[model samples]
Target: MAGVLHRAALRTSRLLQCSKRPSRYHNGSLFFSTSSRRPLMALTGFTETQLTVRDAVSQVCSQFPNTYWQEHDENERDPTDFHATLAKDGWLGIALPEALGGSGLGISEATMMMQAIAESGAGMAGAQSIHANVYATQPLAKFGTAEQLESTIPNIISGRCRVCFGVTEPNSGLDTLRLATAASKQPDGSYRVTGQKIWITCAQVAAKMILLARTTPLEDVEKPSEGLSLFCIDLDRSKHSGLDMRRIKKMGGRAVDANEVFFDNYAIPADSLIGEEGQGFKIILHGMNAERCLLAGEALGLGYAALARATQYAQERTVFQRPIGMNQGIAHPLAEAYMRLEAAKLATYHAARLYDDGSVPAADVGVACNSAKYLAAEAAFAACERAVLTHGGMGYAVEYDVERYFRESLVPRIAPISREMILNYISEKVLGLPRSY
Candidate 1:
């Protein structure tokens, strides 16, 4: 298995190198060469297996049209049917181990699945509706004991269970080490948790929660990051009577719910603990690089979809005797957006390759992941804005569909991690500067 993965990684690298060279064929046609100079296929950095997964996902996405997404957007309804279809098709477990009823694919395949979904014009709403199942329990897969893994992973992989992450807090913000959410040990070996969490996605529909809480006071711990623990607790709304869930109104991605969650002395069984005591922060950080890479791919897909729409509109719309694409003002921005999207896509794929190959250290992967995500978010936003501008008045009109992309593109820039936070990461970690925040 390791050998196969390495060969795939090598092929992916070569494909990326080939893609960077200028294409010899004109008019957007792929050219072949007799002497090892053929132009690389676009999006070719993905391995053959990855490509197969992408094609399969694309095939599924093709069944849903722009009209379908438009209706869903207008109604602010969940894509329960779509989610069920994916679950039935075994897509929800794309990254889980095969023994647990999943295909045991890596992040590359999962990223491609998300990218395909967004590129189909469904945007973040489509991806987020099914994203949590893809990799939300990676820590459990990697760190949980055999018995724990047997109990937790299969239910999630099979879509029989839904889990929401609880990391961000209202007061703590990104300063995770300073979180005040306390989980005190009880006489019965369980823990009583008390805290409030903000901006938790999909909480309203989740049956379980991957929670992080302070197990020891900051002053008593050797480091602020220590004394933190993770729990895969059952969100038994009845037993935890103090637990409160309130949905938040959001600018976009309305199909996937987001909420503020409050916990008041919620009791979680001792068996729910994910790993060794006082190690929640480390476990949570383990998934950050993968999360960033996935987000970058999703953002790249949105940019591609927006650019495709703009290009189509430009070619079809006529003014003053010719297609509007004949004008440089309208055409140049779309072209530039395409180039930016390509650049971001390449960065994201490269980061994924490095991660999969283990060629880069875990900490360095964070830098690469942040770079890819920041670039992709910026590129996607630019492409969506240009798409709307290209459509002129029709863009703002909900009927045109560009406005939906414009609204949805704003999400990748603001959530999970923000542009400012990425900048701070690069400054402090990459450049060895003092922490800004």
Candidate 2:
């Protein structure tokens, strides 16, 4: 198995020809090395760092093929081997700070890495296995104290501590500011949290959770966004009393577990809080945009993968002694899907670039990220649908793998944020229209 993985990794990595240029950091900014020849980069305009990340991540993902993901998805098991392989290769720390045992690369490189992973036939399930690690810790990395950075960041990057993001709740839905989860301060400066968090991914295996709860009561605070606090707290049910998790049987991406976590007066140390008190809504917003960008990349990759499969099938599957691809009716939709995927790819990468630049305005970043996510998810769904239609009967069969892709495509469309919400945001924020919802 090890030898197979090594050879496959090498074969996949050889597909991309990168320049010998290196990416370096100077004064907390990443500068990618440029090449004059620009091999395979004229179309995408990917820098050395981005291309290198894509190549390396594709190599890692190639080891776990479509069948590997299918089996895990069927059995409802986490792809820990795939996760550990990327972690061992230092891919998990692509967007983290260098001083904290990471490569200190920007979101552009991280987005490329995720796209490569999904494009390598792992689909959304594979991309989601380590998704939180890339974005959930952004707030901690930026606002954490010296002690928090020194102890927590290194351990997470090293894969010693796997963490899950806990923000969504059954009652709150998308109204995050109205979350009822409370973290009351105690005499010893510890917090006793009590509430329920639903749809938390990888909670079954994660050792820590980035939890957002109300530190000050809603009535006591002037703004709904205020009174909220974020915490990087222990999630061990065995170690901590009054904490319970019930695994949720989801529609797709079953490889990673989603749970409804219950915290009934679960006590956490005071040091677990991230950033300042009553500032969690602001801090988590940083991660929310990053998550949207990453999800967009994942959606783009899934679309591309599905399109590749459909195109290959169309060319090989013959009907009436001619390839199905020869028919304009069959060919045109695949071409359209390809175009959609390509367009979404551009939007996704553009959002990542805007996010990493740091000089761009927050409203601009929000627009780009939300638009990218909405476009990518819609495109991916269309591509997957077309791929399944192109396959006809085989599309419904799990053996063909398009069925799985089709099911998993819904993830990007409905998760982190919905298409309707994206439209609302663009309407209110971009058009300066009155609030609709």
Candidate 3:
């Protein structure tokens, strides 16, 4: 894994150099492949395997189209059939290793699957439904003990279990170091945790929780980031004592329930700790880039979906004895939206490839992933907005589904990390600017 990361950095550096300097055509011909010129495929340069994964996921998604997702969104219900269908088809473990009964692919493949899901018109609701299942297991895969891995990972891959990521707090927000969540060590080697978590996706339905809590008092630690630990706890949400989970209804992505959770005195066994004590922050950082990559891909898919819908409507809807698409007023915005989405899509996939390369430095991965996330979110939102405008009043109507797309597009701009934070990251980490926050 370390080698993979290192290689990723060198590969990225080389790509940058080539992009900056003129390419020397050592080959006799200067002609590039048609795939390079293609709009969507050019973004990712997906391998044959990845393309196959895309097609397969698309086929599965086609079963439950916009109509299916619209119903789920309107009812504010979980896309149980969509979620189960993907899990049943074994698409849930696209990121897990084959040894653990997974396909053993990388983040690129995972993003492809996720993007296809979103592009199927499932939108954020579709992507969020299975997002944690595909992602949150990595910390365990990379850092957990033998007994822990043997017991937990298989069930996750097989879709017998669902785990909710418990990290963000109501008050702490992005400043994780100051979170008040605490887990005191018990005489029996277990830990008693008490904390509040907000925006915990799928908490209402999750059977397990990958939790992070302060193991040692922050004042006692050398750094604020120290003294924290990660744990995987059995979270059967039947309103048990010391465990309280409540659903928080929101405007969009209603298919997946985001919740507020309170752990009054949750007891977790000693073996549930994912990695070494006081090192949870470092371990958790390992999967952050992957998370960003997946989110970026999802956003890209949504943008493209919106663009497709808008262009299709413009071509079909006739006004003044000609298709709306024939007019520059409608055609130009759709064209611009297409360009923006394609650019963002390229960045998103490029970051995914770099993440999968396993050779990039952590700092480098952070820059790429954050940039991709920011670009994809902005682009997707723009596309959705334009789609709504192109449809005019019909876009605002639920019958057309563009309004839903427009509403759900707001998710990527705010979640995982905010656009302002991404800008701050690039400025401080990449450009060597003084920390703004």
Candidate 4:
């Protein structure tokens, strides 16, 4: 397995370098020289597999300019065309199984795809437009009935259907085991679900959902993690009798919509249930580690993008008739940003490898995932800050594009998981200290 992985990585690297070399026939330079050259070498030290994935994604993303992303963000519209293009090209299903109509690639490839998207100047807006569809179906893929998986996976892979995750709630926050949503089994063997979910990414546009609700009362269940059930249900907006979705306006990633979803006696077929009833929590937990690692990859990309932009601007912008990059004050921060991002990138790829191998224990992957996410988030934040400082007043301006990366960088630090929770995981899980929360 290790040999196979190594070979895969090497092949991917060769393909990446081949794909990314600029065409000599082009009339004009495709990108600013400094920023264009920086990402190639800066990210090359990571796994060849990751670099290959990044290069492929970057090649595809280069078609969409910064102006395209800015327009999408300004209009607060999802980049449906961009997403459909990816879906058509089979990029959206890069991590899914080949039998299920995906490219049959692994999470490592998917992370590189996302990272490259963000690094190409699309930022979170471009990435999140298709993020949920990339990996949110893991529960169904892994634990759903064969019939269920067959019915659902292909449509999602084809981009004919969209799914959103329903996990976080207003009351419970990150204490996922304490969620209050309830699903009662009726005489006809259907589930009547009633609950509210917050921060459901892309819910407003989703046609389906991977939902979790308590099937058995917490007190009645022996384990707190038991009694919770996972479901893959229809989010039929026209049948508004039971489901209500209120779009939440967010500070960044505006091109993709997030929402607060309320379910009141939403009727779903018993077959909609994923895996075993009362095992929903465990099923969902199966994907959380991968999600964190992927987010780290995304953060790593954003950090590299910011650092590349800052370094380029410093080289071109004049100060006292000299390039600002000539001074240590500006040069040192860019170097620091590079170091931090590289460190986080290493952790993210290591976590990805563990996940792909399945040899490491689950607890170990969880800790590593959290560590990657925390480090990547911090690194991305620092890089964006430095980018802003390096660009001076122009960074604050929208046309320069640094501010967009800066704002979008904050989402990864705050969402999916927070830095505080990541530290708590490390302190308790890695050090064997008492739980902090």
Candidate 5:
């Protein structure tokens, strides 16, 4: 697998080689066939398989243009049609194990697929509509019993059901090891859960939730990470009397709903537990690195999308008898943003490749993933801000679309993990400094 990926990377680099000729055409045509007119496949060392995934995902995304995303954002409606289209195309299974009806692709391809979705103008909202399925189930897929895999993975891949991740809480925030949600064991061996989870995306529509809760009180455990358990619980409110979710109106990514979830005596069968009890922290760590890699790719795509729009506007929008792109002030920042995004893209893809290779050390993978996510988020934010500035008055208008990109850029910066936390990690782990947090 590494040999094939290495060959494909070299092939992609050759394809991306820019000739010294004045004409934009390389040999005979543009580097990337996608409408975005950017060599995204080449930017991050795409394998042949990855290139195919990128193009196919980009084609799916092309059907849903900026106008489609604009209407969804304005109405704060779910992009179910877009999500359904991707599922129909079998993209939901891009990173799943083939034994369980998935495409069996690695995180590298998944990152490319997500980047294509965002670059095609779906932004974070479009990519996020189907993001959880790709990463949240990693624990279950690896450690789940045959019964769980046979029943659950197929439905998710085939779009018969949707799942949401429920790890964050209203009071705990980033202190995941200190989660307050509790799932007490009942006499019948079932579990009765009661707790609140905040900022849960897609709770309004998800049929299931991958939840983390304390099976034993913190005081009873030797360590804070102990006694925590993970469960795949039924989130269908109609079937469960105590399960409820209230939508939170957010600043961006309005197409998907974020909610505060309440579980009052929610009953889950004994079979719902994933992996061994008290090992939830260790199991979920696998998915967290995957999340960082995918999120970084999503951020890079959004940045490239904004930069593409700004570059086009600069070239076409005339001011004072000449295109604004003629001025160094306008062109230089866009150029810089492009360079920053490209650098982040490399980091993002490197982290993803490291994740898929599996030969790298776990500590190294964690550092790469967190650093890529942090850099990509910051770079994407700058690109969006510059895009808005390039459009001047029209940037704020929904029709222009940069404002939406700018709003959605904040998601990667804050979700899954924060920039500050990533820094603290690098400091203590890499620099061998004392723990700050």
Candidate 6:
């Protein structure tokens, strides 16, 4: 198995011919190493670091092929084995600081890893199963105290501690400012959190959670974004009386559990509070750029996977004594999808590159990240739809796997943030338009 993985890693790494070029691009300004010949088939012109991340993740994912992912999805089970594989291999900390027992990589590298896994036919289920390790755990490293970091980061780096995020509210929906979950201050300075959180991924199995609640009342606070606080707390299932959880069945991504949780008088220690009080929004926002970039990469990968499947079927499945790929009806959509995915890929990686650059402004990063998410999600959905259409009846079959991809593809379009919200952001922030209702 080791030898097979090594050879596969080498072969997969050869997918892109990246010349000796320094890859760094600002918001729109690109800087490339001078080479008369460009890297053939290099869509985003990845650097050596990004290429290594992509190849390593692809090699790991190669072990769990479509059958593995499809089975987990069909059974509605968590991809715990796959998650363990990645954690054991230290892929969980691909972007973590080296001192924290991670690879000390950047979001760009993490993006490559996710895209590689998704493209390897694991789809969203495979990538998202461990997505929190990279994106959702950012608060710990950025805002956690030294004591918290020492106690927490390593467990997460290993497979010992799995985490989920709890921020969305059933009533608030995307209006985070209007969330009603309250964290009352106890006499001992601890917090007694009582609220309902929904759409929390991995809640069914997570040992920890990054929770956000109103430590101070919204009416008392000057700003709604204020009065919000962040907590990294233990999701002790034994606390059944305090913490109640129920799995939410969905159209896709069944391999991972999404749950609606109720926290009734969930006691949180003072030490579990991250950063300053009433600054949860800022702390959470610190990780949003990375999250958006990584999510975009996942979306781009799913698009590529769907396109690859459709193209393969077009080539091998003959019709009227000719390959369907030779027909314009079958070929054009795939070709169009390729272009769309390529465009989205460029935007996704560009956002990652921008975020990796420390000199870039925060405002620029927000615009780039939002735009990348929007484009990548849109392209991925379109490609999956085309793949389904190309497959016709076979596409709907479980064995074909396009239906799974199609179902999973909707995740990006509707998750983390909606396409409508993203558009509103761009209109207000980038285009300088008045905010729409």
- Each candidate's root-mean-square deviation in Å? 6.1, 7.0, 8.6, 3.9, 4.7, 6.4
Count of clashing residue pairs in every prediction = 0, 0, 10, 0, 0, 0
Q: Would you list the C-alpha lDDT of every candidate in the order shown?
A: 0.78, 0.83, 0.80, 0.80, 0.84, 0.83
Task: Please say which candidate is ahead in TM-score: 3 or 5.
Answer: 5
Candidate 5 clashing pairs, residues 3+ apart or interchain: none
lDDT of 6 at 287: 78
Q: List the residue pairs that clash in candidate 3.
A: 4-358, 4-359, 5-358, 5-359, 5-360, 6-359, 7-359, 8-359, 9-359, 9-360
C-alpha TM-score for every candidate? 0.89, 0.91, 0.90, 0.92, 0.92, 0.91
Given candidate 1, what's the lDDT at residue 359? 67
User: For candidate 5, lDDT tens digit of each residue in 349-379?
Assistant: 8999999888999999999999999999999
Tell me the lDDT of model 2 at 415: 92
Residues 198-257 of candidate 3 have per-residue lDDT tens digits of: 999988878888888999998999999999998889984455658898899798999889
lDDT of 4 by residue, 1-437 (tens): 23323444565566556547753211011233523532332545566555656655666677788888888888888888888877766677777777777766677878878888888788888888877787678767889888997898888877888888899999999889999999999999999999999999888778889998999998998888999999999886766669999999878888889899999998999999998899888889777877887788788777877777787688789989999999999999888888898888888888887887778898888887788889999999999999999999999988877888899999989879788888888888888999978
Give the residue spans of candidate 3 off by over 4 A: 1-44, 238-240
Off by over 4 Å in 6: 1-44, 239-241
Candidate 2 global lDDT: 0.83
Please give me the total number of clashing residue pairs in predicted model 5: 0
Q: How accurate is candidate 6 locally (lDDT)?
A: 0.83
Model 5 residue 151 lDDT score = 91
